[model samples]
Target: MQKKSALGIMVLAILFVSVNLRPAISSIGPLLDTIRADLSLSSSEVSLLTSVPVFCMGLFAPLAVVFNKKLGLKNSIAILVAAIGLFTLLRGILPTYPVLLISAFFIGLSIAIISPLLSAMIKRNFPTRTASLIGVYSFGMGLGATLAAGLTGVFYSVAGWPIALASWGLLAIAAILLWLRVKEPVAEVSELPLEGAASVSPWKNRRAWYMLLFFGFQSALFFSVITWLAPIAIEKGMSILVAGAVLTVMSTVQIACNLSIPLLLERWPSRHLWIMVSLGFGAAGVLLLMFADMIFIWPAAICIGITLGGLFPLALLMPLDENKTADDVNSWSSMIQSGGYIISALTPFTIGLFYDRFQNHMISLSLFLGFIAILTVFAFLLNKKPESAGE
Candidate 1:
């Protein structure tokens, strides 16, 4: 009975923290134009709103190990969540470009570190249930993005961009509260290594590089769609509200798949096959967006949603699948995410730059096709050269 109660709380605590991770980035999409026009920023410059955080998420991911060794998983997450909340709140309170940029960096860093810590947390607590818990974690993030994408427009209409942007921080407060309820097992805490816990960097392995590239391209596709999908909808003669609704559809569809794909993977566990399926959906999504526009907006969103839903959990599983020990999962995941995020971080800003240069959403959308193709190649490569056990 005690065990059941604690597990329930742990699940809720995971949901809360996972939910807070993406809003700082996703919320900006619905309000991008308003922000750009109000602040006199260019498309590329505004793209930094998403890019900077992603950049930090990649560059600072190794800090996860450093944080775990010093503060312990429990305290590290608490501090990071608090920082996420504080920075998110500051965005609304300060409401300046410089402040927004600065706040974005810290928010991204905090999120970056929390990721591996949470993975470590899940590994320690639910060794046998990692896949299901990862689904929960992914679903929570999808839920956060869906809410932000769907409702930030409403929030902006009601209280303006400052409040809409800043209000997301409140999620952190709730996360912190529930997170307190999740007590780490004493044994797990006592076994935590302090000095020289790091393993050979994932960078040293070739298959690890393949995993990084695969993660990077898939993530690039995901973040690009998140940042630009709504604006492209609006460009096709939809209202901001309708555009927001379109993004809502994309994210909502992703949530359903985020939950379902793991179940599907249970039956068919081929990473290459699943990823190829996802990239096919992504290609169709981009083509539809470019050629069909709002006429097939729902279809495009759904296709992209399928692609995102399938790819993320698969990416999360890669290191976990390759590694046996929790430490290996932690080390490989940090390297994969660190390099993957850095590479993926460039897509949004690059798309924005292309839009500015070509003044055409077609060109920006074409880039998606390019990313999908590149991703498909790496997907094939990763499968062709499977990482050896304990590699």
Candidate 2:
């Protein structure tokens, strides 16, 4: 009974923390124009707000392992979550662009630290239920993103961007409080392999490269859409409220997809096939947005959301499926996420630059489609066998 209670607390803590992960960044998407206008930021500068945090996610993920080793997982996560809340609050209160950018970077760094640690926590505590818990984690993230995307405009209308952006910090505060109440189980120590018996690096493996590409492009797609979708809708003549609704719709669909994909993966024999199919939806969605009339934005958003929902969770699960030991999982996850996010961090800024250069979204949408294509090819090329350190 005591063990089950502890497990329950851990699960709740994970879910709450996951819920706080995306809102600080995702909220910016729906309110991009308002923020840009209020601060007199150029498109490129605003794009940096989105891109910097994601870049930090990649830049700072490797440090998570070191922090976990030094501070212990729970304490490290607590400090990071508190930092996230602090920065998020500051992001709203701060008037200067440089201050906002700095806050955004710290928020990203906090998320980066918390992200991998959650995976390691799940792997360590709920080994038997890692996939399911990951699905729940993804679902929480999607849900948070959906709420932020959907409601930021409403909050903006009511109280302006400062309150709208800062409101998300409250959720982080709640998560931190809940996290503080949970006692972490003492982690079992595993002996590091001797120097001669060191595991093969994931970087040397072709399969790991393919997995990284798959993860990277999917992340690019998701971030690009989140950052640009509402603006694209507004450019197509939709009202701010309507654009927010479209984003909300997409995120809502993502929540459903994130929750269900794990179940499908369990039953499906070919993960690659599912990945390809999901990528196809993403490509089709981009194409739809590229060519379709504004009236069809609803369907386009749904397609994109479905793609994000399915692909994001699957991308996360792939690393766990591919690696054997917890150490290998950590190493591969760090490598894949670090490299993938660095690549992904470019998407929004590049797409924004393309839009700025061409004064049209065609080139940007085309670039997004190209990323989908790359991800599809990589998905097809992924190895059928599970990854082993010996390999």
Best-performing candidate as measured by lDDT: 1
- What TM-score does each of the candidates earn? 0.92, 0.92
Can you tell me which runs of candidate 2 are displaced by over 4 Å? Answer: 188-198, 383-391
Error of 1 at 136 (Å): 1.8
User: C-alpha displacement of 348 in model 2, angstroms?
Assistant: 0.5
Model 1 lDDT per residue over 53-97, tens place: 999998886687677778877788889999999999998888999
Tens digits of per-residue lDDT, candidate 2, 1-391, equal 9878888888888889999999989998998887888888777788888899999999987677677778987888899998888888886688578977898899999898788778767767887997678867877888889999999999888988888888888897888888997885735222221111217788888787888888889999999999999999998998778899999999998888887776787789567767877877888888889999998889989888889888887887776787666667666777787899998998998887877777777787888789888887787677456455455
lDDT (C-alpha, whole model) for all candidates: 0.85, 0.82
- Which 10 consecutive positions of candidate 2 have the poorest summed lDDT? 189-198
Q: In model 1, which regions exceed 4 Å deviation?
A: 186-201, 323-325, 385-391
| Deviation in Å, model 1, residue 270 alpha carbon | 2.6
